[model samples]
Target: MRNKSIKKLNNKMNSKKVIVTFLILVCTIFNIGAQNITPDSKVLYKKVNGDSLYLHLFKPEISKKPTAAIVFFFGGGWVGGNPKQFYQQSKYFASRGILAISAEYRVKNTHGTSPFECVEDGKSAIRWVRENAKELNIDPNKIVASGGSAGGHVALTTALIKGLENVDENLSVSSVPNAVVAYNPVSDTTLKGYGSKKVVGRETEISPTDQVKKDMPPMLIFHGTKDKTVPFENAERFTRLMKEAGNDCELVAVDNMGHGFFNGDFFRKGTGNKYFNLTAYKTDVFLEKLCYLKEKPTLAENIKQVSCIGDSNTEATYPKFLQEKLGENYQVKNFGKGGATLIEGTNHPYFKKKEYKNSLKFTPDIVLIMFGTNDANVKWCLDKTRKTKFIGTPQEEFKSQYIKLINTYKRKNENAEIYVLTPLPIYEHAKSRDPEIKKRIKHLYDWVIPIIREIAEEQNVKLIDVNKLMKKAYKYTVDGIHLNQKGYKILAKKIAKEIK
Candidate 1:
């Protein structure tokens, strides 16, 4: 009886031990998942209203020394807005090897403050970022100020306007960013533009467009043509003034779109993703151009990739030259198949090829599309039978198809920077191949190149004017249609200039 009691007690204790171990494992897993899902954030300042303003920080898992940083302010017309508005953008920049921050500032709803106070807080946040650059492991010189709508005004104020500095901030530390990315910003606060009533006494004090300076940071602005709250002309006027002042500013006007179109949440769930994705992708390209980011975008394990999609031209030697030019920092893959057309069900359709599938699988950070050479073939475009099978006119079909291709890659990787390449021009002699080839050359120059240019413009993706560049080097091509080694070298140089 004594031995039986002892064995029973031992079994009960062992059961308790197992239960405890399992519970501990479950808790550990949950904790790790929570950490991964939630980013690290901290309070940067405490206001007189007893509310703490926090900076939600998203630091890259892997970063090179002296990392670049981008700070975003939320838009709410100085009435109300949440730092969460830019969380997605911050997360994206963090993944690209930059320290990204979404800062909370004083707003009318919580602090009962005016736009001027908001501007002061904006400057303080930037100053804090600059002051703590060492602690944040970021390069102060590469800081980028970014925001949307009212918040965009704050961002611009950091660069263009002055005198709204916080008393506690170190005046020696500059709040101005090396670059700016603004979305539908209320750039003009005068009587003609947004927030005119709010800035009644001090119109020019907060008007970014009115304060354009010669040495302001390079800026990229995204605005909708149909925005009512902030007129589309505001963006145009601001960019024009910046350019006139000898500053670089790029304005991307989204057609038929309205206010707050840059934000995904502005539309119904899953509806406005395209606008958000394109804007984010363009910002990445702009940052890369400024040399703020490394040559290639940082992916998991520090790997970066570039996927080139096209026809014989991309397949021959350009990809190799690109690989050499990019050096060891990138995995350059040529997904080019010979005699491939951009259109589906065409002779040697590229969309149906394995290279296309491979390119999608690669999940590249940068995609270069150079198609249209084969699609412009006279037999493909002018054939009555083929034309009958096509979904629309050659130009319409081409535009829709190119947009489809861009959206496909964008869906695969929203961060990828897609570049559309114009088909290279054929030399005058190469046009003599046959009646069909001569007609193809004419179609390429007359119909195809213009169609691609229109698509690029409409889609708002960067266009590489390969036709224009190749025209200058047509002498390097042996047959006018295909480029020789010398021609490939020139092509590579131009591509490198654009991408690198």
Candidate 2:
């Protein structure tokens, strides 16, 4: 009776442990956020313990030469997680002209294995990719391993640990990845860190901190400072050890975020790209440094990209005619926010919008900037309650910001040709009854345009005096503020001459 009671007590304890593990692992994977992205193709990589494992490939449309590839492993505490967890990231890498893969690895609940097998499966997946590099049209030497949480541990073990090899496979092809990109990965797996109980006797053998050595592949890690599952200290320790051994390792500690903070959240769609897009951008920067992939899509050599930065005028007008005028040689992209200002303190600043980020991304060979018309919106520059003492003048901020905006573009691409255009003259604006435009129109004429000219001369950027060119063209404007098709065509001709 005593023996039976002891077994019953142990069984209850195991049941509760399973429940806790399930909750934590479920949050790590964030299965609900996984997108239904279909890979370009799926291939059977290996079979183990009567289960066949496959790889999800996100390949570019064309692979003329053997390009670099990145492989991703999903996190589930070595327990439960979907192969689709990294689909969003995989698709993005594919779009960037590289081969990307998300692998299926053994897990505790599904494969009836320990955490060690998860590491083994990660190695096997990389080995298979290397072995079939020619078939996949990827450079075998430049493979990158990436993952989050437990999957990150798996990825790191493939590069750090060597003993967990499958017996049947040929041992010649190296399984270690050329580089690593981890998102909140479990860097340590010993008694002092996470999953130590799961690994049991072989903790140090697979712990990345223990395996750090000289001349290892470069590593880039992103970890949330507030993560409890995988303590943030583990990341710090692993990086320190890596550098001590003369290896290159960088750790990006995300502030005040918890576990699974790197997962792609579909709900964060617009300007508030909390984590997903921001992390992806950082990931690309890391990969670009390692030569794994280019950060942006490759354009044909003959085509130069143009980024048009401005207000409602650039959005609704001249860009249409500018594209036609630039002809087949240039690809023009309009990044104009309707009510945006040069001054960031205003309610609608272009610097705070997604359009600004997108503008810098297209690899612009030429940048045309036009503002000042919208800075004339007197209300945007005001403090919440102007009834109180005046904070400062908008003109004071505009001069600095205009120079700052020009310098921003120059910093983005040193070789990029930048042009600063003056705002078109407002002869009579019927749609805009703003007291400033109707009354002192001098706000734009006297205060705004002169600042624009000063910015161009001070910054050494080329100047296009659009306000001077469109002086008497009021008949071609829709509301004397916005241009019609004919007005824009005339305006495009003037800008096109400067570009040529």
Whose TM-score is greatest here?
2
C-alpha local distance difference test of each model? 0.76, 0.76
TM-score for each candidate, following the candidate numbering: 0.53, 0.54
* Predicted candidate 1, C-alpha RMSD: 16.7
RMSD in Å for candidate 2, one decimal? 13.7
Candidate 2, 188-307: lDDT as tens digits: 889778989888888888889988888888998999999989999999999999999999999999877789877653322221123555576677777888777764522121345588
What does each candidate score in C-alpha RMSD? 16.7, 13.7
Tens-digit per-residue lDDT, 1-500, candidate 1: 12343343323322311122333222221111111234444545435457677777776654337788998999999999988777666766776678888889989898888999888888888887887776666898999999999999888888987788866657898978889999999999998899988878888888998899899999999999999999999899999999999999999998877887666422222222345556777888899999887664322112256788999899989987886676544556778999898766576887788888888866677899998888888777666577334577877777777888899999887878889999888755644454567677888888888988888888878899998877877677766678889789789888988987
